[model samples]
Target chain A: MKLLESGVVSENRKHIISFIILAATLLLVFPLVFDIFRLNLVAKYLSLAFAAVGLVICWGHGGILSLGQGVFWGLGGYCLAAFLKLEAAVNIANEAGTDQIKALTTVGLPDFMDWNQITELPYIWYPFKSFPITLICVLIVPGIVAFIIGLAIFKRRVSGVYFAIITQALCWIMEILFVTRQGWTGGINGITDLRTCLGWDIRTQAAQYTLYFLTAGLLLAVILFSKKILSSKLGQLLVAIRDMEDRVRFSGYDVSNFKIFSFCLAAMISAVGGALFVLNVGFMSPKLVTIAPSIYMVIFCALGGRESLIGVVYGTLIVCFGRTYFSEQFPELWMFLMGGIFIVVTVACPKGLAGLFESHGAKALAFLKKFLKIENLASKDKKEVEA
Target chain B: MSSTDYALYIENLTVSFDGFKAVDDVSIYVEKGTVHVVIGPNGAGKTTLLDLVCGKTKPTAGKIKFDDYDLTTMHEQDIVQAGVGRKFQTPSIYPSLTVFENLEVSYPKGRGVWGALGFKRDQEVIDRIHEVADMIYLSDKLQTPGELLSHGQKQWLEIGMLLIADLQMILLDEPVAGMSVVERKQTADLLRKISQNRSILVIEHDMNFVREIAHRVNVMHQGKVIAEGSMETVEKNEKVIEVYLGH
Candidate 1:
């Protein structure tokens, strides 16, 4: 017998269908409706959504608000950027021919490095030359960093506002370091003018569309994976820790390991998003890895429902799109409008847009059922109302 | 010193905050398969002694051995993994989770990262949850959010959480602090029933409840064990009377 038909459709089946519909809309409907330019913009936003999703788990659910998520995102972004920059440099080196390459001395260097008067590739950028190594670093670097942070803080029982403050400070430190180390990190401008990934021209319109679909596919997979984690016994443990850490510790569970796991998982996911952001946007910069952006990442998760995974995705898209539109349209009032939304969301709707939908979604469904004249639906709702 | 005879052994455990000693020179031993109760006045450091035993609070000077392992320097979770469970003074349950989930997370099946991710609610887990729910008088309230349970039920649920795992030593701090008369009586009976195989260290103040369940009672006063014997004997001890019962 089908599980949905076993009279348990209201909870599990409804959620599955909603997730499926969301995936379809992102994968199919958006591409069909929006032009390549708009779709590409969406891909960029979706990459940011990855960070927000991490916040949904780490901050929203686990109750560990890391204001330094941008540090991980930047690490992942830089790893990919360094590889692509090297690849572009290699292509330039080959095109210049052996004699010209010798004369130029900057033939093997990325243009920014050459402009900065670097004679040889730095030791740090050497590992990024290999795609496999860069790929591994994209996930591992962030995961290890998060693990270390989780260990230091969680083990010592540092949490809540203090953890948030520390993370924010870390984000600031990363931004300053990246910006000041001009020869290594390309300074304020960041690594830009990326032409290809491996040999394929990522700059072309067709490639942008392809990357959009890839981003969409990856986002859906990540959402499904997160759903699985949230449904598992581990997810419950996280919530238990969030509610009562000491109680959980005394219950025979290693609470810090769970916290570290969640932190690393969130970091790895954000790292993936960072990689995709570089692919879609064709640039990596200190701007994206600063304290302001990190806080914005958390705001996206807050606006999406912290407890609701799908709600977080929708929240990211809405906030990102709203930011562009509001900034472009009302330039001066954008920050004010954003501040107002934050206040309203926090005070009036603490659960964000998802909470708003939940309160009225059932009524809307019932109204739809009545309008469509679906047999037995309105009657059941009416009976429930009477009761 | 022979760990086989005592499930838990503590010698000269002392914890001081600044110049003041919260738990000073407190020595205790619990025999396997017996319910040992610690009765004291409000500031007699009953909770602190339990804290020292469970590794929640580090001792300034002491040796705490559980079975054959030294626990004074171990982590709280490590101490727990060594088969010790602690219930706090107030009901410290996951309020948002259902009573079943609250117990299931502590079921000791998937204690590690991968184990928890792939943990299944098999027949054994289901059977255990049902058994524990019934034991706590929460069989009908399995689906209820833990926060919504009555004061007595929440207390029982916290104790039920401790039983979900495989534990040899259980420490309960004020297990029936705010319970009604009937709930307290029921709890006294429940403790006696659960203590058949495991060693229990309970910090309690109610003398009547202590007399009802304690196989051996220790009266503490001013961070010291004033008397230790059967409930009848300890009640008659002049020092215990002067420091605790007289008050």
Candidate 2:
């Protein structure tokens, strides 16, 4: 414990300490200081932070600035929303085949219910008839998609700015495809009218609180999980693959496998966050998959300090909470304000908000070490004289 | 297997990139436990030979047979598993990982994505890590980040990482390129100690470094091995003198 403290905590405990304090403060009663609507808004922003931390791993450490994580987030959200939407349609149906017929009609079923030949929904859609399927698809759908994507991209050695451009292209292309294709993905309107998640009635205040707390719990788990990954042997390979790939190859490692691991993990984390996001908001749409939202995800990660977990959360909260204050008054100024911060961070700080906080004391430590060296030299000289 | 039965046998090996032959029609063989150094002036394709052996680049044509197995078609990682460890011109240890962790990373099955996450190093593996670290005189820096080390220390750590793989053959590409004289001497000594029981091939631009480490030197020019013999014999060869040793 002492060794760990001297190595890690002694340098700076402020970020971790401040995070605990803020979490405690929120647990105390933002519920009392603010209304349920406001609390839900706070919950939503934190959920975004969970996803951004996932970005930090791939973009910051792995040297892959992924812009298509929004796709995973969208997948998770829609999978859950689809299952939930499917469940809604099933329960609200009066006749056996009519609801099924109406859904097909909604997709181009034909003139009348009599024309419908199929009595049952697709086999794959059957499990979604239950609430559990809705809940699990939130993670499983994105997990599968990310696994496939990671396999293809990493196998091809797509990395650096080229990888970033490809991922960003993926984000915009997916958004366009989703917007245009009304048959499969429901067009720009997206999957809406989600009344509940699992068995929880989302319309009630109790359910809202349940989701609010779930978001908080999920964020904490992801923060700890990301920290563990970044500190592990897997993390060492990821960074090695980033900084000196050719060298890593000579050292007998399969660099592609490590890249795939990081990509897949990042995808799963974002997927979970996205699912939690839709639960609190009761919506999923093509608007969520656009380049703008992907860019916003990057903005929050940059603001938070790409290297620091807590910084990402703080940056997410600041941008999201601050938006409400600016949306009504100087809506035009909001983007510019963020743009200016990005420029300053990229040019001056380069480490983001956490870097800004820790650098103050980091400089002092560097000075102290220098002073200690001189002291040690003087002591050695005195010992020689005594000898 | 007999020495004549092939530790390494390359036949009609040819490699090119964008129509330029990096390695063209190169073939060589090594007996087990032999220390062979490849030497040449700049652009002689010595590094390319090592790259081909280590599977860093694929050949356009030919066979690289190690023992009974053909190595020309193998993946870089599989070639590594087939007992070929490469140390590059620059130190390539993980700058973020401690020396022990860096060594642990290359410890055979301690790699791979799934295995790396769930498998903790066994005591035997950990002890081997210590042994390698001690051999490289990096015991003090076991807990220190590779980035925090001096240039010589990084070199030693890279070697230590390779040593933990316990391969039958090692390929070192310009291993003493960026080291101090004292560090160079130590690396020569370390290579001598390891080469007693393993087949070792090294690429060197320096005749002096090759002399210090080579049991026999093979001088390469234009992607082909031109002359092979004892250091003194190769240095005195007319072809080698006219092409590589002109300076």
Candidate 3:
């Protein structure tokens, strides 16, 4: 009994160590391997990977596939963009004298709003002027939206493909609303020319590097927190609810509350990713918050092995990088090729890289162990540290 | 007993789908610490009766009260929280999780989202898990995934899950439907053992198994109880024999 218990504990330790090593590599390795431009792109991809991580738990583990993650991501992105836009507006007014200020704006509106012939800053945009409020909105807006949606849908027992379709429609609705509401959002042009965040001049290469590290650090922390939730009793209930929802209910669990909580948490995580994304990418557009990107987010979770957090990170990086590479090289054929990959991956490996690793990863690791002639990686490191 | 001698009180319950009555104005009472088996032919609305009581199906009229709680207005989870546990016709366990986890999830503590996040499998939980595991003969398969268990073992695991919650009443639908002869006998024994502490409402087709475990038997026909008595008395009931046995 004692030996059996210790074996289980050791296996958990191995997984934890592997996760830490992977996170450390992600955090430190890219800066050494790539220049600022490439690292900035990586940071951008990691930000999307945040939404993918949420998908891993909410859709993969909980069996609630949300095809509208872009709504939350967009919400978060726009919140930050609005804040930066407000900062730029204030800066513009300050630089220009009071005489020029009256000439520059009807009531100190954003340049885009002025260009679109809007005189006054909207009431909603007033709150974004405060950085603290913007930060809070970035997290709270998406969370509250998700909570209400989850409450309405889950309480009525709407789930599976129906839930996915409803969320997909929600993405399209939000996208259209953002595009058509020109004064509120920047419409087709989006909130652009975001030059500074709190007078820090974010366009500089040094700022880019700092943002890259910060995004990496934040992603790593979210992954660890997600990992903790996945290992808890709540995680087991999620699987149980996924397999047999009625059974979980029969066992005295408020199934809808669990669903709501997970959806809300996923939304908040995606919002954080979105805010960081705006910081790295320097823009927030309605185009990024549509059904297509939302579906792409689902595919990111799928290709990464919907079940594996690290697999999701790699999935997002590989797919995003591949898209950029292919689009630049082939342009027209990239879409065809990407579509083919999605179809093949879905058909061939439904569980994604995680499932593949589960079946073959151990064999590959063992083969490497024998070929390298370096005793067990885990114990060897332990022995070295002991010595 | 108190004012209510029954653990489960059903008064003129009726459920209709479209215009057809699935469970018509039927009333049944299950005394505390007793096994009350409902035996009927197919489409006799036996399962629907159990469903209405467990809040899986809402009745068109009448009331279901579990002890002091009016269960007709409660949701399935709330009914369970009110100390009613239900097992479906099929073995509904999380196939990917271990047998221990299958039971651990139903331990009735730390059930909410935040509570479950910090729930640790302390010695008390572990001990209860082991006790239930031994009772269900799943102790050896504690670490084994539920999918690996045989159908009978899976059924036992589901029952063990309900037991871990410390329920006041248990509802079983076709508990021995696919069990082997030996497995059926063991299930009967298990049901008998569990009924010593709480009320059990079983919907069974196998008259022999019902005969083994029933303290009182209610024979139903076409959505209404045709006979209600001890097994010996119900077997001799001409209406029950004709509708069910057809002799």
For model 2, the stretches where C-alpha displacement exceeds 4 angstroms are A1-22, A29-33, A90-124, A361-387, B1-6, B17-20
Tens digits of lDDT, candidate 1, A333-370: 99888888888887888988878878877788889998
Stretches of candidate 1 exceeding 4 Å from the true structure: A1-10, A94-102, A378-387, B1-3
Chain B TM-score per candidate, please.
Answer: 0.97, 0.93, 0.97
Residues A78-141, candidate 3: write the lDDT tens digits. 9999999888887888788668688658545788888778887888898898999999999999
Write candidate 3's Cα lDDT for B133-228 as tens digits: 999877888988899999999999999999999999999988888899999999999999999999899999888898899999888889988889
- Residue pair clashes in candidate 1: none
* Candidate 2 vs 3: which has more TM-score: 3
Q: Alpha carbon lDDT of residue A61, candidate 2? A: 79
DockQ of the two-chain complex in candidate 3: 0.76
User: lDDT score, residue B69, model 3?
Assistant: 92
The TM-score between candidate 1 and the true structure equals 0.95
Best by TM-score: 3
| Residue pairs with backbone overlap in model 3 | none
Chain A of candidate 1 gets a TM-score of 0.93
Q: All models, DockQ values?
A: 0.61, 0.56, 0.76
Off by over 4 Å in 3: A1-4, A7-11, A106-108, A375-387, B1-3
lDDT ranking, high to low: 3, 1, 2
Considering every candidate listed, which one attains the maximal DockQ?
3
